[model samples]
Target: MPAGSFTMGDSSGDRNRADGETPRHQVALSAFEIDATTVTNDDFARFVEATGCITEAESFGFSAVFHLAIDAPPEDVMGPATGTPWWSGVKGADWRHPGGRFTDLEGRGDHPVVHVSWNDAQAYCEWAGRRLPTEAEWEYAARGGIDGAKYPWGDQEVDEGGWRANIFQGEFPRRNTGEDGFPTTAPVRTFAPNGYGLWQSVGNVWEWCEDRFHPATYRRGTTAEKRTTVTDPVGPADGQARVMRGGSYLCHDSYCNRYRNSARSQNTPDSSMGNAGFRTVSRRGAER
Candidate 1:
């Protein structure tokens, strides 16, 4: 973690949705340590080899598979699979089998491991002697001293002649030319790191925070969100789902741009998909 303050919401010039990221407020965070990149296939493999931890997606026997990896033609692609057939409920899909069918993490050991749920992430953190950062800490570290800029890099458009992060570049759900050097997910740290030396805090995948998802928690709550200032603001006690930050490769400006620093979303703790993964944080004196 890095000690700093940022505007903590969408700026005045931002035309994005103003619901979750409204009334830009000041946020301060203390120094902490976050993973240089998301836990990759190789990283998770080490944990699995040691602990024999089977992820929920692996134990449950099915995980969400991106439609792009399916055999369906472009015209055959349908609605959101998590709702419709947009995601294939493939057997054997887990951190090892990203696509669930015949795909494996064989040659792509550096790519960020997917199909991990909140429970899975927490278990990994415990095994690694770290914990998930709160939503506030995640945002603070993600800002990278830019102070409330739209993205981890800055407010400039993504294609401003530099590789800022990995996300959908072309028209989504139809064509992806891989102009960003990746159509799905580039390897973790495929691009540059933020000012604090944090990697992939904005794209590649949406990381799970320790906080619970609350629609108005930031505005009206007795817990972490409402407190004016604190050392480490953990989220609410209970909720339907956990908070997810730093949107995923599936994020698109035309659709889900929650990849922005202020943007947020959530899912059930047990739900695992290709677009959701996580990183861990360690306190100053905590065991490494």
Candidate 2:
């Protein structure tokens, strides 16, 4: 994507107000090229086959999976995970077996690889000779050159044009009607590309960004004199949770409506889940 300036954060003030989606600020970024799609199972498989790298999920012997999508045995499904009753920690859940031990990459090789932590994404980037897009770069690229737009494709509601992206439909947690033609994850390139030729930058799977996360990261310059135009901001210098952009397949309007371009979420670098994945970027031009 070409370098440009855009006002970052929730201009609509419609979603994730308290989750650091406010204080829409002007941000300028340099030219960079991002992967058109999130890293797919097929792409990650090649990396593993060449390096024999073991993902954190595989090393831990378990990963988080949505309750409704858990295909593991009753014993392997270790109930819900505290406050998030919708998510459960399942044994033998990894990228290869997304649903659980019983599941495999039968027809889902083209889908975004899940059960990948930020560290795992970094490892993949290292192996592929690329890097995760910084939070600023991500938002800039996600906007597709459309400043202040709620989504990659414009401010029209996600479902306003007949299932623009893959996200939870019908009910949340309890049931998904698959009104978007996907109950869980859709293919990496299932939707139309943004103006910059980027695909699924809003919904599908949460793409990890290369920045430490903090709810107050945006507030640093909110005070008057310091509130000048930030050029290529890199988020907080230190934090336990890394940034995750692009809401996942489980996102829904009734609950987690964070699938917008300015929406932000975070998780520990070692944490892995079925709803998360990442794409890579080339900062020094489009070499990849």
Report the lDDT tens digits of candidate 1 across residue range 1-288.
Answer: 546665666673443443356545566666788888888889988998999998898788777767775533333333355444556666666777776556677778988888999999989988998888888888888888888588778887767877778888777767766778887778887788888788889878989988888766555433445436444556667788899999888777887777788887888999998888888888443221
**Runs in model 1 with CA error above 4 Å?**
12-19, 71-85, 221-231, 283-288
The alpha-carbon lDDT assigned to residue 163 of candidate 1 equals: 70
- Per the 3 Å backbone cut-off, how many clashing residue pairs does candidate 1 have? 4
Q: Any runs in candidate 2 off by more than 4 Å, and if so which?
A: 222-227, 283-288
Q: Which ten residues in a row have the lowest lDDT in candidate 1?
A: 70-79
Using lDDT as the measure, the top candidate is: 2
Q: List all candidate RMSDs to the true structure.
A: 3.8, 2.2
Query: Which 10-residue window in model 2 sums to the lowest lDDT?
Result: 279-288
Query: Mind giving the per-residue lDDT tens digits that candidate 2 earns over 200-241?
Result: 998899999988888888887455644568887777777899
